[model samples]
Structures are given as structure tokens and as C-alpha cells.
Target: MSDTTGGLLTIAALIILLAAVHKPFGDYMAHVFTSAKHWRVEKRIYRVLGVNADSEQSARSYTVSVLGFSLISIVVLFLILVGQKALPFDRGLPGMPWDMSLNTAVSFVTNTNWQSYSGESTLGFAAQAGGLVIQNFLSAAVGIAVAIALVRGFVRSRSGELGNFWVDLVRGTIRILLPLSFVAAILLVSQGVIQNFGDHTVHALTGGTQVIPGGPVASQESIKELGTNGGGFFNGNSSHPFENGTPFSNLIELFLLLVIPVSLTRTLGTMVGSRKQGYAILGAMTFMFGAALAVVTWAEAGMHSQAAQLAGGSMEGKETQFGSWASSLFATATTGTSTGAINSAHDSLSPTGGGTVLVNMMLGEVAPGGVGAGIYGILVMAVVTVFIAGLMVGRTPEILGKKIGTKEMTYVALYTLSVPAIILVGIGLAIALHGTPGYMNNPGSHGFSEVVYAFTSAANNNGSAFAGITVTSHFFQISLAAAMLLGRFIPIALVLGLAGSLAKQGKVPVTAGTLPTHTPLFASLLVGVILLVTGLTFFPALALGPLAEALS
Candidate 1:
């Protein structure tokens, strides 16, 4: 088959697969959440923590308790990071630098998983297993809790409260993520991904000594993809042999990264009592994802062709074992879900491929994005799109029985625009400063894309980078760090507030006149909205980078 035909086929196959999975996974989540069996497990956990799980608590009280527990977790993890060298479980590596500790702790807590510190040289095994791994699970759990809270808003009658945040957090972590992680971690270990307390060893290679990196890699690897926490256990990330040892392991990791994001669509439909609604959203996400994958794959393949002719520009930053297609696919997938694990250095990818990754991140990562955050984030955009379209068509906008009113539209607009505002402004300031003699590297268009992509990744909680850019400077560090924190928290706070407001409103019953969000019409509109918003914001910047590369 021709490349074009193959691309079309693959796109169709993915949509069908997602649509098929929707009902089953949706039913599974609905059953798990409403089941008495799971309640027993929640009760046990609450009992262990000395809280009366069965007590009738207000929503405000529950939210406070959940936030309080998260704060405590953050403090404990911070202490572990700060004192890892002196801690008993330290495997002899030096303790984390103060700034690095703060960055890692904040990164993990925010689910951004941005790592400024080198994994092999700086962190000890204890910190990896105890602090980082624990946060991976907890951070993902936070996303799932937020998603469930949003679901409660759609399900509840007129009430100020959605659901108990504490209960949602506990149930999501214990009942869903923990159990899945256990299975996935074991599978990873079986595939030669490491899991142990053994010290790092030196292997005698043909010419020189090579340090063989080891740690609780399997545990972190499982949740890294599962929770959409993309921080890798090693500096090389999934490209590292220990983290992804085999082709089988590679496929499994990719699937895990996609599973929850895909599954949540089903959960959304289930909560709203319409499986088609979830399918529509999934269709839209899959279409954008498939387009990204095709462009990235073609760009990389074309680069390999160019490299063959030049007999130069070795694909040095990529994994030879995985080859170009796998590496390109991984790059696309990582950004697609806001999971930043890279099997190859994106910076070295042909300009077009790297540009695709940048644009993908800039799309607010709503293409079935970060864990629970992705689905809800995209849905907010979908709501906004419907609202706009409704205005043109002279109709009230309703999505899955929830009316898209002025208040909800305001929240969506703010949430969607918040990160783009930070990213654009940060990049603009960086270029203006760097264009001066002292800071210029390449001092041209490509350099600007690197800065823009970095801020976009950080601000959107997508951690992939164009590795060529030197981001270690204080200016880059401070700017990107601020972007990461605000981009991560602001949207989350807005979504939560929207959910609270929505919970207080009565659901508008679906009628014959209601616009079906599940159909191809709505899916197409959602895609158009995503492209229009992202394209309009970033077109000039994109023309500067990938477009230039392609033309040249």
C-alpha cells in the first residue's frame, strides 16, 4: 500500500479500536466506583489512616482532607529528596542539589515530571524507589480524582457539591492505579526492565569500562506511563536499556501510556449515561493523534533518507534498536498524552518532526492528554467549540446533558488560554534577551523554536525538549520553572471550579433537538476548534521553525 493509503487505514483502525474499548472500560469504571466491593477497600484504607470512611462529611471537609494529605505527602517526599544521601536506603550516589530537589518535588507533585537533574549521577536508589516512584502513583491519582469530580458534576442533581474529594482520591489510587501498577511492574521486570536494590555496576566492554545503570526502574517505568508521569528512572529515559529492555517491553510501555487516557473516555461516557458522547471525544482525539503520528513518522523517514545521501548527520541521539519509526512514534505518543518520556532526542529529529512534536504540545495536550487531565481538558475545549458553533446556529449548547452556559464558557476560555499566554510571553522575552550578543547560540529561527518548544512543554506539563537548547542558564531555568508551575496549577484550579459550579446546576435532559456530541459532525468541529486555536496562536512561530526547515 502507498504511504497515504496506509496512513488512512491506520487512522481508521485506531478509531475503531478506541470506539470498541469505550463501552467496556466505561462499564468497568462505573461498576468499580459504584460497587460495594470497592467501598470495603476504601473503608479499610480510611480505617488504617484513622479516618471514619463511613462518616457523612461535607464536600468542603472532604476536599480539605484530601488536599491536606497531598500536602503531607509532598513534605515527606521533599525531605527524602533533600536528605537522600544520609538516608538509610541511599545507594551511595550523592544527594540531590537544593534547586534540583525543589524542581523534582514540584515537577512530580504537579504531574509535569520535568527533570533538570541527571538521574544516574545525582539520585540514590532510595530516593528513586521511595520518593519519585511514590509520587508517580500519587500524582496520577490526583488527576483521576479530578476527573471523577468532574464526572460527579454531570451526574449529580442541583447541589453545590460534586463528590467527596478524599474518597475519590483514595478509591482512584487504591482501587485503580495501585492494582494496575503492580501487574505492570511485574511484567516490566520479566521483560528485563530492572527492579532491585543492587548497587550500580561497571561492565567490562570491548574497549573501556561502561557504567551499567540500575535501580527500581521497573516500578517507576510502570507508573511513569500508567500515570502519564513522564519522568524517566534514568537520564536516557525509555531509550535506556534498563527502562525498556526489549521490543515487547517497548510496546507494553506505549500501550500503558495510552490505556488510561483512552479508558477515561469510556468513563466519561459512563458518567454521562451516553457511551456515544465518549466515543465522539475519542474520535476527535484519535484523529489528531493519528495525524501527528503520520507526519512525525514520515518526517523521520525522510530525514534518514537525507542522512544516507550526505553520509553525515548520524541519528546519534536515537536508539538504533528501535529504529526511526518506533522512536518517532514514541515521540509523538509521549507528547500526545503529556507524558514526556523520550526514546530519542527530539532536538536532533529533522526539523519537521521536531516541529510536529512542538505543535502537538502547544495544542494544550487535549488529544487524550495527561491522565485524567487530558480528557477533561479536551472536553472543556469541546464545550467551548460547541458553545461557539451554537451561537452561529441559533441554539443552546449542551454536551452530555450539561448546558454550556456563559459561566462554563468563561471557565473553558480561561483554562484553554492560560498556558498559551504563558508560553508565548515567555518565548518572546527569551528571544528578545538572547538576541543580544551575550546569549545567542545559533542566533536564528531554529533557536527561537527551541525556546518556544521548551516553554510550551514546561508550561503545558509536557516535559519533552529539543535537547540542543542549553536550558541550564538561570534565565531559562527561572522562566521555564514559573511557566511549569502556573501552567500546571492554573488550569487544574479552573477545571475544579468549573466542576463545582456545574454540580450546582441541574442537568438539561437530552431532547430531540439536542446536538449529538457523539457524531462525526461534532468530532469534526472539535478538531477544527483545536487546530484553529493552536494554529492561530503558533503559526508565525511555526513558520519560523518547521516551515523554514521544510522549504530549505
Candidate 2:
């Protein structure tokens, strides 16, 4: 098959596999969250934590629980990394620097996984498995818990409670993420992704010797992609052959990135009592994802850079061990979701190609966004779309039988506008501190794009970078940490509140003037709504960066 055909086929087959498992997986998720009975093991953990599994909490309480758990996690994890020299399996790596350790702690716990330090050299196997790996499961569980809480808001009426946060978190991890990750890890190991913790091995050669580092990689690799927490065990990320050993390993990682995020649409649909509602959201996400893939794939195929012009593509920084087709595919999948495990350096991508990645993240990563994040983020957009369309058609905006009122719209407005505010302001701060902390390797429009992409990645919690900027200074470590926290928890808190408001609301009967949100027309409008917000917010900065370079 042609390379283009192969790339397209890979995406198609991946989507098909997702669809094949969607109903079963999604339904299982719903059951896990909503079932009355808990497993004996889960019951034991709940008792130990002093959790009341039977009593659901209000949105405020749930939010607090999430925050409290995360804060404790951050402190605990920070200590683990900072004192790793004194811990077991130190592997001769000492304690990390305080600021970098804090940043790493906050990043992983928040599900951003934006590494300011290389994992292989900085973190030992014990820290990776105990601290980072465990957070991989918990952070993702937190996301699913929030999404399930929001779903409960729509599915339950006259009920002020969302759900028991402890229950949801436990069930999501044990029942959902753990099993899937076990299987994915095995597959990765079978394909030669490293699974052991043996130390560095030196192979003697005729002239010299080569040192190879090894750790418990495949276990961490599975959840890193599956949970949409894209921190790599190695600095090369998926590009490292040891992490992604073959073309099939590349495909496996790509599929893992997309599987949960996409199936989440079905999970949303199943929970809300209308499968069509979920399909509408899924349709909008798919359309946007496909559009992004097309642009990036096309742009990569074009010869925009001097080297690319000669080589017929920008092969630099790409995983040539596979092919450009696979790298392009990985780029599309990585950016489309908040998963930032790259098989290629996005900095070397053509202007349009890299800009597409920026645009995808700037749109709040809702093109089948991060694990539990995708469904809730797009649902908020749907609410905004319904409200606008309702205003235009001169009627009430109702979705899944709930009225979109001032309270609902208020939460939606806060959730939608907050990220851009964080992005624009964070960019301003970084640029003000430029020439030092925000140093860029490239100059002109391309350099500007690097700064823009970093804050965009942080504020949207995507965690991928253009890789041309120097961001290891105090300013970036602190500012980007702040961005990742707000970008993640703030919207989640608001979403739960909106869910709370919607849950307390009475289901209004469908009137003749109600906008049909499940139809293709509404799906189109939903896409428009998403673009409208992202475009209006980021267009000026984007134009100044990537667009300027492309035009010049």
C-alpha cells in the first residue's frame, strides 16, 4: 500500500477497534461507577480510608475531596522524588532539585506529565513504579470520577448529590484502568518494550563499549498512554526504540492514546440514557480529529523546511526506525488528545503541521480530549452551543431533558473562558521574561511559536512541546506548574457544579422550539462553537507565530 494509504488505514483500523470495544467498555465503566455493590477488596480500601461509599456528596464536597487527595499526593510524591537518594532502588541517582521535583510532582498528579527533567537519569525504578506509576492510575481515576459525577448530574433528577468520590475513584482504577493497562503492558512487552529493572549494561566492542540503561518501562508505558499521562520513562519518549520497539509498538501506543478518550463518548451516552446524545458529541470530536490529521499529514508530506525540501519531508527528529507515515500518525493522535507522547519532534514539523497541533490543544483538547476529560469538556461546549443556538432560534436550550439556564451557562462560561485567560496571561508573563527563562533556539516567527506552544500545551494540559525553547528556569517551572493546575482542576470543579445544577433541575418537556442537539445540524454547530471559542481567543497570538512564519 502507498504510505498515505497505510497511514489512513492505520487510523481507520484504530478507530474501528475503538468502536468494536466502545459499547462493552463504556457500559462497563457506567456499571463500575453506578453499581450498588462494591468488590470486597474495594470495600476494604474504603474502610481503611474512612470513606462512606454509600453516601454521595455535593459538588463542593466532591471537589474538595479531589483537591485534598491531590494535594496530599503532591506532597507525598514530592518528598519521594526529593529524597530518592535515600530510598530503595536508588540506582545511584541522587535527590532531584526542589523546583524541578515540585514541577514533576504537580505535573504527574495533575495528569499533565510535563517533564522538566529527563526521567531515565533523574528518576529511579522505585520512584517510577511507586510514585509516578501509581499517580498514573490515580490521576486518571480522578478524571473519570469527575466525568462520572457530571454524568450523574444529567442521569439523576431532583438529586443534589453527584456520587461518592472515593467510590468512583476506586472503581475507575480497579475495575477499569488497571485491567486495560495490564493487557496493554503485556502486549508492549511481547513487542519488546522493556519490562525489567536491570541496571545499565555495558557491551564491549572492538573500539569501545556501549552502555544501555534498563528499568521497569513497559508497566509505566502502558498507563502513560492509556491514561493520557504522556510522561516518558526515557527522554526520547515514544521515539526511543526501547519504549516503542517496532512499528507495531508505535501502533499500540497510538491506539492506547485514542481508545479511552474516544470510547468516553459512548460512556457519556450510556450514562445519560440516550446513546444518540453521546454519538453527537463523538461525531463532533471525530470530525475535528479527522480535520487535524488531514492537515498535519498533508503539511508533513510537503517540503516546507530547507532540509525537508531536499528530502521530500522533514525527516529530522522523526522516528525513522518506523517511517514518516507512522510519525505523522503518532503526531496526529498525540495532539488530537492531551496525550503528549511524541514519536517525532514537533519543532521540526512544517509551520502548518505544528500549528495544527497548537490549534488542537488550544481548542481545549476536546477532539476526543484526555481520558475522562474528553466527554466533560465537549459536553460543556455542547451546552454553550445549545444556549447560543437557542438564543438564535428564539427558544429554550435543552439537552438530554435538562434546561440550560443562567446557573448552567455561568459554569459553562467559567469553564470555557478560564483556559484562554490562563493561556494569554501566562504567555504574556513568559514573553515578558523572555531572553532568559523563555529562551528560544530559533528566532523570528518560529521562535515566537515555540513560546506560544509551551503555554498552550500547559494551559490545555496537553504537555507536548515544540522543543525549541529553554524552559528550565524558575519562572517557567513555577508559571507552567500554576497553568497545569488551573487548567485541569478549575474546569473540573466548574463542571461538577454545572452537573450539580443540572441534577437539581427538573427535566423540561421537549417543546417544538427546542433545538435538536443529537442531529447532524447540531453536531455541525457544536463543531462551530468549539472553533469559535478557540479561534476568537488564540487567533491573534497564533497569527503572530505560526501563521506569520508560514506566510513569510
Tens digits of lDDT, candidate 2, 91-193? 9999989988888899999888888888887888898999999999999899889988888888888988999999999988999889989999999998889
Q: Which regions of candidate 2 fall more than 4 Å away from where they truly are?
A: 204-206
Clashing pairs in 2: none
Which model scores highest in TM-score?
A: 2
Off by over 4 Å in 1: 1-23, 36-41, 48-73, 200-208, 304-309, 312-314, 434-443
Q: Across residues 1-552, which tens digit of lDDT does each residue of candidate 1 receive?
A: 664554444445545655576567667776665554446667777778786544433345545554566567757877888888887657676666566666677778778887777788778888888798888888888887777777777777687775556566777778778888889899999889998776555657676676676677888999998888899888889999899987668777877788788888888888777778888888899899989998888877664434434755336577776766677778888999989998998877777788889889988887779988898788788888888888987898877678888888888889888988998899888878834224434446666667777888889887877756766566765677778778876776677777777777887877888877889999999999999999999898899876776576
